[model samples]
Target: MTPSHPPISGASSRRLGFLLAAGAAVLFSAKAILAKFQFRYGLDALDVMALRMGLALPLFALLAVRESRRAAAPLQARDRALILVLGVLGYYLSSLLDFWGLQYVPVSLERLILFLNPTFVLLLGVVLFKRRVARREWVALAVSYAGVALVFVESLRLEGDHLALGGALVLGAALAYALYLALSGELIHRVGPLRLVAYAMLVSTAVTAIHYVIARDPAGLLRLSAPVYGLALVNAVLCTFAPVTMTMAAVARIGSGAAAQLSALGPVSLLFLRGWLLGESVSALQVLGTAVVLCGVLLLARPAANSVPLDPIDDPLPGQAGNPPGR
Candidate 1:
């Protein structure tokens, strides 16, 4: 008789997934801090964005190539174009606006604003898909916005005019990214999360490159400070690539709802990182606002009664139809 191995338990698998999700959240939380550090070197938003995308391009390109080779069915032209448009909206524009906003906003406030993405996602679903909102969802929405308003008022008092500009830009970034999330469900179902992310990032990389060329000469990229380059590389690898892959992997294992709940760690981690690295101050009101926002989002994340628990199409098992072996 052949020897049999013990199957992994569901609890163990969920534990691993939670760890991966937590790790991804922490890394992603560092992004604003890293961007702020790069700004200290007198680099403009475009310059910093160019460096980040330029450095990240090769890694994502390789990922795309690997996924393409493994795919049984090739993508159609229409699919390619759709991915490009989504990439431009989600990664390029959202990232560019966030970077521009960071120039004028505190890292803590920037993260708090970005944390409101789920609200935008809910609103988009209601508007575009004609989804009905439950009474609880409405209350959650109100609580979330109230939290943001509280933080926004505090930020305005502290940072003045710059806060207004930065907050608006970051909020725009959140909205753009929310649209990407809402619209990507179909594509993500067809293409695996890893493959979709890779292709989308490659598209975003090309767009950022062209934008950099239009804005600055080739020599300008070469002239960035050493520290700026270092931070960019770290941001590319740690914040961008690793967190994305890990989060997707976590979603695959634990489901999107659980993964998202773990992601609430993001802003909280940012709070700690900002205080430690950037010497940023946090007010009691800001902390309370953060808690309220997180509570509201958590409430929204819970499934309704009679709802079937289904993992997102993006969460595919390894070596499954949409997912390939070895990432």
Candidate 2:
């Protein structure tokens, strides 16, 4: 028989998990910064999105092919239909709204808004599924929105232009993604998680391509600057692909709870990075707001009595459990 390998120590496993989770959070947050840089290079949100998705499409296709080969059975008609709807709601619409919102708002604010996805998810459950909310959950939701309001008011005070519009767009993006998460539970069980994500990504990319062609001249995409393409490549590979895999691995190693907890680092990193890279001002109130928001989300993320925990595998995005609601 082959020699058996030594089992990893618990501490070592935990340490590795923390590193992976933290790294995934940072990488995902960096996507906004990368898009901002591309903006300076004269690309619109659609242009940037097209490049990002186009470059990433090949890899996602490869993943889909690999997962398909490993599947025990082919996708059923109902499963295919659900995947199409989710692909539109989750990846395409949500990501497009987010990219457009980033054009008007500071990266710091955008990151914070996306971080509020957990709250949106909770609200969606209450309205759609008629789920009962506990007193603590209500408190958590109130505290979370209060913190976001704090940051929003501060942002308006400093530079008010388009703040409301940008915030609304980002909020819509969060809600759209929340709806996807809520509806995807059963479908995830029907299809394997990796296969589902891969298939959904393929669908989203097709939609992105069509949006780009109809909205803008396809020829212009060929004339973009080298830096634009380079940034798009990095955004696609580093931010999109790498963090997705890393978060999955992290969750597997440490469980979604610890991984999600560690992902609180995303907003914090964005807060500072915005000032350093994008020259956006950072304020004390923003810091406090970030802290308050994290506390509320952590509270909401707390495991319920005898309830199933959030599954990161069910999330199709990078930094899946980085938010309590698996954004």
Candidate 3:
């Protein structure tokens, strides 16, 4: 495949792109809800992580093989090393922190915290690369954090106790992912998005498996209820694997900017899903906070009039600028 394809102009193509992008966002956001569900069955964060990634390992391995064969050239030594580092930071560490945070926080708050990756990426650019921050971008960050604050306060009031720890853990997850995004720009260009994602996921899967073996009883997996295994399968396939593929395909059909715009649906969908499936009530404060965060993030996401069109391979998922297509 080429770096860029001809613009897909038909209404049907565009509509399919919209549906794919929207559905991918919802599916990605639903991971938190799935984790919360597993928690009710006495599964800890590592238990869920082990089950989810273990179940998904074979699929990820196949993706790695498929993308490797499709690559323009074989990966160099440096590229292999970078994949190891990024796989750890982007998927392993970030995902561990996120899963642990879910043990403490509500799904709504967890989704909102993860949704702040765009802002974290912005700040990382300024701090690490000496990139200039536009004034509007600062305002956007402020607005976004203020909204998070509102929800944080509301969550604290209701959930109490472990809210602070959970919020911190999720925030750390967002920051670690931001680091991955900040550093992965050149690698994505050289390796191709799908290839990079597949290889990186394979690396993470290996690390996660080792961690599970060292810290957990592998035999415990067999004792889990059928429902737990069923949910793990759904979470691994529907939430993780399917969304990555669907979002990338959506980016190919539409443009990245347009596809990213649809990502705002993620948190919104999670909010309703939590209420309907988990019986968690939606509060007015949570609603207002969500609106404000969406406004701020969308403001950052708006493309400049003279901006170069983003490559479909550059941004495989929504919710962040140049997000590298894995949950």
- The prediction achieving the highest lDDT against the true structure is 3
Each prediction's whole-model lDDT (CA): 0.74, 0.77, 0.82
- Give TM per candidate: 0.89, 0.91, 0.93
Q: Please give the distance, in angstroms, between residue 210's alpha carbon in candidate 3 and its true position after superposition.
A: 0.8
Residues 1-327, model 1: lDDT tens digits: 001112234888878888987888778778888888988888878887888888888888898888888887888888888899888987899989999999999887777777777667767867886666667778888998898888889877877788989988988988888778777766765776678889888888889988888877968788767788899999999888888777767766776656667777878887777878998888888888888888877676654511323334422122111111111
| Candidate 2 clashing pairs, residues 3+ apart or interchain | none
- Which residue pairs in candidate 3 have backbone atoms (N, alpha carbon, C) closer than 3 angstroms, thus clashing? none
Task: Arrange candidates, best lDDT first.
Answer: 3, 2, 1
Name the TM-score of candidate 2.
0.91
Q: C-alpha displacement of 44 in model 2, angstroms?
A: 1.1
Q: How do the residues 1-327 of candidate 2 rate in per-residue lDDT, one tens digit apiece?
A: 001112234888868977988988889889999999999988877887888888988888898899899888899999999899988988889888898999888888888888877667667766876666677878887888888899999988886879899888888888888778777766765676667877888898999889888887899989988888899999999888777677767766777666767778889999989999989998999889888888887676655521333344432332233452213
Worst 10 residues of 1 by lDDT: 318-327
| RMSD from true fold, candidate 3 | 3.3
